[model samples]
Target: MDLKPLLNKLENYHTEKPNRVFTMYLNTDPADPDQQGGEWRLQLKNGLNNFETYLQEDGDSDEKRNYWAVKEKVQHYINENERNLKKSVIIIATADEDIWFAETLQMPVKTEFFWEEQPQLRQLKELQKSFPKTGIILTQKDQVKYIDAELGTVKDTALYELDLDTEDWRQHQGPHRADSNLGSGGAKTSKKDELAERFEANRARWYKSIAPELDQIAKKHHWERIYLVGPSDEVNDLEQHMNKKVEGKINKNLLDHEETKVLNEVV
Candidate 1:
């Protein structure tokens, strides 16, 4: 997303007039902060009422209209955009009854309103510093698990499952010593090398098959960052085969950690 144009536009906008900017950071999640604890609807009402009180005291003649318009707009935005009801909402508007920006964010924000010379971009900056849209791909030799994870709020939901072909990976004793050149150590070494090569080939094939699927799932989830957890060889192979989007967003892989402990490692 290109922000230069938008930033330039905003810079040009407020310079035109004393635009009464209203900044609201709302806790849209049903589990509101303890200070405003109640059911979701009640919490929303309380938040808006708090804003209304502030505007009534600090605002001018058009304050009532601003209160109603902003209240309706904010409520409608929350209802329309929230999916998991685990996200917070940020709305920046002008007293001229124009909504400058509104966004549903994965991480929670303290419910507060700010009246400043410029729009409140500090919160946005903080959010960008700690992005919440992330996905986890935990890969082992034979099985792959995809988890939709959010960094800030510790949200980890198992989304899809991809079980790869495991036959080649399974352990099996090589041909009996008698089957090889009898009493020949060179023959045993040759057998071991052959088995290792075949195992590597099978693992390569597995990587090739699953890399695209993993990429597709990450795109589907709109993950801004991807965390890989797997063996060193497999992780390296997957990185080479991953699509440009996945490759660009790859966070460091947890090659030293087991698959089961990825959750602990990521958060």
Candidate 2:
């Protein structure tokens, strides 16, 4: 979801109880055949248990009591919200009983528990470095794909494929320019140029159709960082047609079309 706002809010939070922040990095991709999603609970349990050892070693008696007072609260939160987590989940609990949650596309491999005088955000800072609030649009002549990536997770938000005739591209071609007065080969050159323009026009039509949808998705999801990944020419055309809201979020355009490769670059 939208984490930038939550992060901003957490930055200002004040708490009297030992500020205990529970950061759990989980792999929630159930579709992956090799992943065992059922182990997340046990991982979280072990993580908190390890944190208790760290706390006992590092803190005085008063600080230790304050930290453990809210152990059950954090566990309750995990139980209630476990199903909503995506690839990565960050939970923050303070002595003031304020609980905050952020779900991201990026999942980290470890669980970290921290208690300090104030909110601990080191994990979030590191995550933001690798996973910015970004949306990716992957385009092809026959199909268009919209993916929203933030934190550490990647989601396929939308996909569109051309449903018209297989030879519709042929319609963009026309008879070679036949003007004879310019030069012997001017006709061929002019015809090729005209055909190129027609081809671009067709591509533009396809790009325009998805531009608004991308705009809606970005705004609805509060995606402030946008990446356009596809052929250079088509990506350029698509950006030109996007609404100002989406246009302002355009951070980069990549010269690639394969979704897996694009994910490697963005992720």
Off by over 4 Å in 1: 1-19, 27-36, 39-47, 50-64, 78-84, 93-106, 115-117, 132-135, 140-200, 205-225, 230-233, 240-265
The C-alpha stretches of model 2 lying farther than 4 A from their native spots are 18-89, 94-97, 102-112, 162-201, 243-261
Candidate 2: tens digits of C-alpha lDDT, residues 73-154:
6677667876675555566665446655645343554455555555677777777767676677765444456767666566
Q: Which tens-of-lDDT digit does each residue in 7-113 have in candidate 1?
A: 45545555222335667776666555563553555666776787678757866646567556756776777778656455577787765654467766556787776
Top model number, TM-score:
2
Candidate 1: residue pairs that collide:
none
In terms of lDDT, the best-performing candidate is 2
Indicate the worst ten consecutive residues by lDDT in candidate 2: 176-185
